[model samples]
Target: MPGFLSLRTKTTSIVALMVAVTMACGGVMIWNTYRVDRLIEGMVSDSVAAYQAAEALETALVNQKGFMSYYVMDRNPEWLQRLGEYRQLFRMRLERAQGFAGTAEERDTLASIGDAYDLYVAAKDKALGLYINGDEIAGGEAHAGVRDQFFKILDHCEAYKKAHEEELFAARQAVHARAEQLRWVTVAALVFVTGLGGVLTLMLGRQVLAPLRRLAREEAGELALMEPNEVKAVTHRIENLIRSAGEAHTELARSRENLLMAEKMVLVGKLAAGMAHSIRNPMTSVKMRLFSLNRSLPLTREQEEDFQVITREIGQVDTIVQNFLEFSRPPRLAMQLESPSTVVDRVLQLLSHRLRSYEVTVEVKREKPLPNVTCDPEQLKEAFVNFMENACKAMGGGGRIVITERVVSETDGAGLAEISFADTGCGIPEEELEQVFQPFFTTREDGTGLGLPISQRIIENHGGWIDVDSVQGKGTTFVVYLPMDSEEKK
Candidate 1:
């Protein structure tokens, strides 16, 4: 009940039912016709057999009369034999008529004819014997008796034929009646099926087709009024709006974080600048005084060792101050059209000694005819160096670094040249992946954590982006997508 059929299926089923009804009607008509035909055939056959039997009896009787006259006149033995043969033929015809009888009345009439025929045969035989024995008077009396019996037998044969004819007529009437009944029934069935089919068709048209046509008309009108180019333009604008909104949301969040980080960097830069200025003046005076003291008086071994340690400590502080200042305020980029592969090759060459010392294998993969990207070669090389050094540090014992370059097309119809740095080293955790680009966020004790932030800034300034994917136990991959076309350059 829940999965009831649609109007179309119901209509089709109704039509099929009508067709089946028509076929059933046709079958009934055929069966009735066959029954009637069989009845008529049996009646006709019986009638023909009865008629033939009557005709044979009449012919035999005529032959017997001719033979009796010949035998009575000639009184010859051959004439008596011919008379006997005709008598036998008459008896055979009566027997055949009895066999052809269909009804009980007809059989009774044939039986009576058989009894009369037997008496006639016996009298004729006696008459034939008397004629042969030279008693013509008694033989004539015997022949007279045979004629009376023949008339009675003839009457019975006529009755049998009449009965068959009556039966034939009755059978014809019954066939006509059955045929008439079949005709009326077939007509009624056809009318009923046709009427039902018509009603179903009308209902289907009203319920199913009418609504479909209305919907089609409405859709056609809408389509006719709309221009293809206008529709496409609207769709394109909507898609652009959606993409812009998403990008703006992501950029806003990133901007908030970057703003906080920039403020902190600015404050650190100011503090480092002040500290360096203050510390360098005092340290320069201390170095000058030491040089003057060493030149004025001779120094012992323990005293010289103490002087060397102080100098080394002062140098380490200066190095720390310089690193902080550089991290706070990076240098300006000198942008140019440079091959990414060339920058990568230069970095690998510069780090060759360090990489070999750590037993790290470096591999660069690039297809033929690599595209040049608009970027600062020095900045890009420095970024690559920082990535490679981090990879090498992660694999303290030994590991492999693979760099692959290729051209990729963005969904916005912009072409970008992508470089991927994949290292088989300990990877960052999933939780820390998001904060990897934040300044001063590092797992390493000696790491400044400003390397990735600086690298991300450099890539963004060149109208590009950086992405990372890593599994903690497996390895890490860093992908840089830079715009290849000049229009992308700022």
Candidate 2:
């Protein structure tokens, strides 16, 4: 059943994707239209540039030939060297004009231009050789025949240039007409594609997401009666729905577990109450009798000190019993606007004695003027104490601990206060990290293991998250991000 549903869903998704892609493709048509216009404009501009270069080269060739003719007619050696430079300029222009010719007619004109160019070069070379050989009179007579042939070649070059220009003009006009036609076609295609996309979006909205959303609601409504197998089946079919449903199931499981824990705590409280009643009277009598004996005894200083030690040990036992009684009873609501910095300071104060004895240093860095957060001050203190105590214990001997407070914004338009506690200690193993947050999970021999879990519950009740990151053999960092209330801001 899951496989069938998955296939159907995938098919629908693919169809919708194709529609979106086709719509995007249509958008490129307008760009194509503009590209065609540019092409036409470029063709005309390039052709004109080519024609101008050709015209300049032809004129330069004529000038160079005229100079060569004068040098030959007069048998002058001065103008010979300058002729080579002018010939180079003419070649450059001819090369440029060669690019503008496309069809057979244009090619034939270029071929004629090439023949004329060769004739000019041959006539100039012959004249220069004769002048160099010191046969001025003979060179002048030979130049007379070559000079007439040179003019005919120049005439042919000019005619070819005129014919090439006409062909380029006609080609430019045809290209412009084709470019306009392509532009209109592209525009029509673009409009049609855009309209197609809107239609596709409308179709998908009507066909896929709406029905899938309804199906999701239906599946959610039937979650409780679902067995593990049923859940697996649904997960295989609808992954997104499965994720949201998993959260709901998790919350339901937590509620059930908490109810069981509360029942167990009630039984423990009853036992604690009975046990206290049995021990309190005897402890009180002993404490009072010891107090009297200490004062009455006129003993040596060492003996008096021994007596004081006995009393102090008894008092410590009493304190432990009292703490147990308090733990059995639930705490009351004591929400207040308290500074996070003050909380960190108080926790540091509580750990001062141990900090000195263990040689552990605690550092606090806070953002200035932090907003107040509404929470039970005592619970917050307990959470911080539990975390700090755990961190200190993890360090084993001595380490640096850092605490910081800052505000952050979440994607949901809610502002949160983020508090971090980090310690340089032997970090938890990757396998053990997740279990560290569970009740009765501990790495220490004598740890109650309830400290972290209870602290987590307290924070969670106030709409906050407690996340842990640890690197084995490096350190651990615990982050608490809690949403802020309106009054807390000020």
Candidate with the greatest TM-score versus the true structure: 2
lDDT of 2 by residue, 1-490 (tens): 1434564575566566656655655556556567666766765676666667668767877777666666756856667667777878777777777776566776777677777678757865776678768877776776787777767767766776676577677877776776676667667656766665665577667666566555545675555245334444445457766787999899999999789777767766776697698876688889999889888978799988888898887786675555456557657758888876777788889889988877789888875846888888788888899899889899989998998889888898688888888999999999998878665567887565667876787788678989999999999999998789866653
Superposition TM-score, candidate 2 onto the true structure: 0.46
Local distance difference test, per candidate? 0.80, 0.74
TM-score, per-candidate, Cα-based: 0.45, 0.46
State the local distance difference test value for candidate 2. Answer: 0.74
Model 1, 288-338: lDDT tens digits are 887788778888999888888887777766655665676777888898887
State the displacement of the C-alpha of residue 178, model 2, in Å, after optimal TM-score superposition: 40
Per-residue error (Å), model 1, residue 390? 0.6
